[model samples]
Target chain A: MNQDSLAYLPASKLARLLASGELTSVELSRSVLERAEHLNAQVNAFLGWDGEDLMAQAEASDKRRKADKALGFFDGIPVALKNNIAVKGSLLTCGSRMLENFVSPYDATVVERMKAAGMLVWGRLNMDEFAMGSSTETSYFGSTANPWDLTRTPGGSSGGSAAALAAGMSPITLGSDTGGSIRQPAAFCGIYGLKPTYGRVSRYGLVAFASSLDQIGPFGHCVEDVARMMEVLCGVDPKDSSSYPAPVSPFHAELELALTGGRPMVLGLPVEYFKEDGLDPAVRRAMDEVVAYYKGIGWQIKDVSLPNSHLAVPTYYVIATAEASSNLARFDGIRYTHRSESASDAVDVYFKSRGEGFGEEVKRRIILGTFVLSSGYHDAYYLKAQLVRTLIRNDFSKAFGEVDLVLTPTTPSPAFVRGERITDPLQMYLNDIYTICPNLTGLPAISVPCGFASQNLPVGFQLIAPHFEEVRLLTAARAYEKGNDWHTRHPAL
Target chain B: MEHIDIGYTAKLARLELSKDEQELYSAQLGRILEYFHVLSSVDTSGVEPTAHANPLHNVLREDVAVPGFGAGPALANAPQQREDQVLVPRVIE
Candidate 1:
């Protein structure tokens, strides 16, 4: 296969090739790394790259294959991890100056699992500072540009992960989602992104953004690759208390069945998401096309109501910032890197270190979170937001009772220009308007590239399923993906 | 709606904001919090606050200790480290 095609082939196809001895893990790793090195100047997708370590892992996988002791399907697959997810002995900067020099001493649970599966993992992708922003402009490393249009953003928090996948830097990647970090970027970059049901994957190594809302999920170019990743990623870990103890479904097997099944699928279109005002014309057109396509394919499409949808952005900001304030308190200069040079006392050290270490968006969130959780404002803001969260969850539960899955636009619009929304925090927060509700309800949601807009930017169709129903979600997504070519399209660099 | 005192909140957050940052964040946060006022319209009077979406409770593990990263790795990322300990600014002098 040509180098360009080799770089962009799905992990499933790559795995098959590896098994048949058509390609070595070392060759695949080199192709991916070469592409990444060539594109790094313009894309800024990776924050750290360990070529030596990566080649060593690839050699080990090749050796395993030669010995007829291959670990798993992912034995030779190259995978990139969002920086927030720990990989031992690597710099785990969550795109912040606070932990800029910090090196992880232990592997995150997912990293351990991937290592066991024999995946070649080495790159640390850039993200918003502490995964706090929607546009990745907040990253201290620099904003990751959209691969499609170099001037536009790749969407964020998990922006670099999505960009890397879109640029074919890696066949599969892991990203943490809290308030749409994974899905939004996936939508923006026109790839498949899944935010698994909260607690479906262990968060032991994934840094906490919002304890209740955070989840680590996969980003890939196709639904089957994502499902294949789920087979390796899902399972209860004693390390993460919130991880569900339910037995993991055979996702890859279920996906194959879902693709070949003859049953007509029922999908709900929440009426609130399709409102004419403020919705982008191209996105509306894409949704219409997808709904029409599904209807033409003998799928049932019905209108459902998620009445509490409008409150998702506000409620997410309140709860996320509040949790961020508490979670980020561990970053005092004493424990981690990035201590201030001018500090006479402990209190002064904290004030100055945090002040200098965190960027503007991080500070803004810290203050907002602190304000909401402060004694007098807790009940009014924090508690009130939590109650609203229940109402939001109830909306999804009610809709799920009537429909097998709910469908919505992954983002309100296609990827915006680099500096378009960064200046306005409210505008940036609104970017997650359609994506955040899934996190709030802890539903399994996936964003699949459905079509393109006038500017040639990608538009994604989001499918949400009830908790732990990732199989059904991926199956449904695959049914759509098999009939469309959007996921296969790569940006011309 | 109550107006936020940026100075007071910054102090509470342990952030030392400069004059420009305080002004910028003060206006930005004011707009955001003011926007949050919309949540008050929803009647959550009797609703129990949900700390987590899933209902898994008491996820306990055995008391057996697993070997951990030794002190060398534990203190590896510290900005300032002494022998086997992180060195912070003097607490009492």
Candidate 2:
């Protein structure tokens, strides 16, 4: 196969090639690195990657295969990680100046699992500064442009992870989602990204954004590739008490079984989400087509109401910022983060260092968070938001009782122009309007390429399942993929 | 609610905002807070706050002595270090 075909093959296909001795891990890793290097200036997807380190890991996978002790079916595949997830000795900058030069001393639990599964850990993808913004524009390094349209953003704060997969720089990558960080970008970049149910994946060593809302998930070109990743990524982590104490599902096997079964799912369309006001016509059209497609395939479709989902954005901002203020307090210019040279006293260190280290969006959030959690406003804002959050969660629980899964447009629109919304924080926050509800409800949601909008920018539709029901979620997503060629279409690079 | 005091909020956050930032944040935050008033429309009477998505709380692990990251690695990323100690500006002065 030529470079484009080889580079863009799904991880499942690559695994087969490696297992059959038709390809070597070194060759695959080298070509991927070369493609990534060639495209980095245009897409700006990766922060940086060590080619030697990746090749060494790839070689080890090959050695294991040679000894008939290959780790698993996914051995020798390369997986990139968003900058926030740590890998020992690797730069762990969460696209922020605070950790611009900081390196991790230990691997995140997911990283340990990835190594054990023999997946080659590759590039450090870029993201929003402290995962605070919708567009990658807030990243301290630079913004990552959408591969489909260079002038537009790859939705973030996991923009780089989505763009890397779209540009064929990496076959599979991992991203953290707190309020649609993974799903929104995946929608923009036209790839499959799954935000596993909260607590389904461990957060140990993941730079905390909103501890309660954050989840680490996989992104890939196909549903099975993401399912393959889930096989090893799930399960309890001793270090992360929040991780669910559950057995790992045979995701790949489940994918095969799900693909062969008839579509017996009842998909719910949340009426509140389908409002005509803000949703772009193109996105609305794509979602309508997806609903029609499922209906024609003998699947049940019902209109459901999530009356309280409108409060998700406000509730999210309050709760996320409140948590961020507390979570980020550890960065006091004294520990493993940036310290201002102008500090003359101990207290001055915090003010000067944080001001210098954080970006505009990050500061805005920190201030907002602090204000909400501050004296006298706690019950009115932070606590009130949490109580409202319970209502939003109740909305989903009520909807799930009537439907097997919930389906909605992953975003309000396709990839937007890079600078179109950055100046307006509220406008940027709304980009995640459709995707954040699942995060609030702690439900598993997957974004798959539904169709293309105007200008050929890809749009995605999300399918959400009950908590810990990834098997059903991935199965349903794969059912959609099998009937469409959207996942196979690549951006003209 | 009235406009948030940018100076007070930034101070509480231990962040120093420039004059431009203060002005920008004051207007932006004012609009955002105004938007948040929509929450007051909901009847959250007697609703218990959901602090976490999962019900797991106070998860206790066996109190066993295990190896920890040695001081060398622990302080490896500290901005300023002396031997095994992290040096901060003297707080007692």
Candidate 3:
């Protein structure tokens, strides 16, 4: 096996090589580190990388294998994590200055699981400050550029994870999707990203964004790699009370079965989604190709109506910000966050520290949240948004009654240039128009690279399944991915 | 679009804002809230609110004392600490 290409190999193929003694964990770790060293200057995907720590974990994995006590198929693989997900002793920055110097004192539940399985915790990937932006540009550290096109954004707040995996810095990485964070970036970087059903994965140590909508999911070069990640990552955790009390789907097994031949599924196309004004011609073309492919494969495609789909963006922003205002109240200056040296009193610490710590977008959302949840406006904005949220969730439940899955374009368009939409917050928020409903409805959705658009940028189509139906979701994704070469095509970086 | 008092809202949220920030955010928030006005048109009469996404239950555990992270780890990231306590600006004048 050529060591130079080891970092880019699929996790499944890498596992087979490790089992066959064709590759050592140390060799693979070194290769990944070397690739990051070469590409990180351009991609800016990582917030922090510790070569010594990574090698230590890799050495342990190798020693375990040598002693015939290997943990499992993924024992030695390096999986990067979005910085918001805590790893003890690592900086849990969330790409914000508030926690820039704060080190996690304990592992997140997901990190604990990865360590238990002997998978090396690779490093912290960059993200929008506190997972609040559609593009990675909001990150305090710096924006992560698309490996596909250096001038454009790798979609965000999980842009770093997507970019890192797309650049072959890690075989796979995990990201939290509050709205379109994971899927949008995955779409932009031309990889696969899965936003698991809400509560399907624990969020114990994931720094809270919008608690109800935040879900940690995987990004990978192929559908199988993401399924492999789900196999290890999914499960109930007592630490995260919201984690579902459900059996972990044998994702890889189910995906393999689906690929060979799963029952034909009824895929729904939301008429509202297709009819939206901003639907890029290129994105629509990609979705058309996906619909045609699925139809060719004998799957049923039907036009469905999500009458309340137009309200998704408004409802999501209202609810997300209200929750964010409450959730972010924990970041007072006294604790493990940036304290304002200019403060003269306790109250000043709260106000000035936050003012200093948070970026423009975060502060904007916090104020928006505060306004909606304020005493007089609570019923008018916050409660009204929640009531509409029910309508949005009901839209999905109603549609699922007619179809096995819902398919749509993951993003409104291909990756926009770095500064294109940053100045216009509404335009940036609109980017999540198609992606937000799943977060609101608590459904599982995956973004699969459908084809490239103009400028050679990647376009992704999303497949959403009913709550906790990741098996069906991944199976459908595999069905589309089996003969498609989009996921295999890498950026020239 | 409803009028937003940026000064009052920021105070309620306990976030200090610069004069320039207040101006920029006010205009932006006005536009965003105007966009949010669309939700008002949806006649969601008598519809129940969906606060938690998934079906949730109160996770009850035996009322027993359990070992928690000690002061050392808890204070490890504190911006300022003294004798295992996080130090902050004086609360009482």
CA deviation > 4 Å runs, candidate 2: A259-263
Off by over 4 Å in 3: A1-3
Residues A381-458, candidate 1, lDDT per residue (tens digit)? 999999999999988889988889999999999999998888899989988888998888889899999889977899
Pairs that collide, model 2: none
Native interface contact recovery, all models = 0.86, 0.89, 0.91
For model 2, residues A1-493, the per-residue Cα lDDT tens digits are: 5567787899999999999999989889988988998899999999999999999999999999999999988999999999999999999999999999999999999999999999998899999998888889999999999999999999999999999999999999999999999999999999999999899899998999999999999999898899989987998988998898866879878767876764588999999888748999999999888988888778899999999888988999999999998899888898889999999899999999999999999999999999999999999999999999999999999998999899999998899998999999998887778888778778899999999988999999999999999998988887788789998989999
* Residue A286 of model 3, lDDT score: 88
Candidate 2, position A69, lDDT: 94
Q: lDDT of candidate 2 vs native?
A: 0.91
Give the runs in model 1 whose Cα sits over 4 Å from its true position.
Answer: none
- DockQ, each predicted model: 0.84, 0.87, 0.86
The total number of steric clashes, by the backbone 3 Å criterion, in model 2 comes to: 0
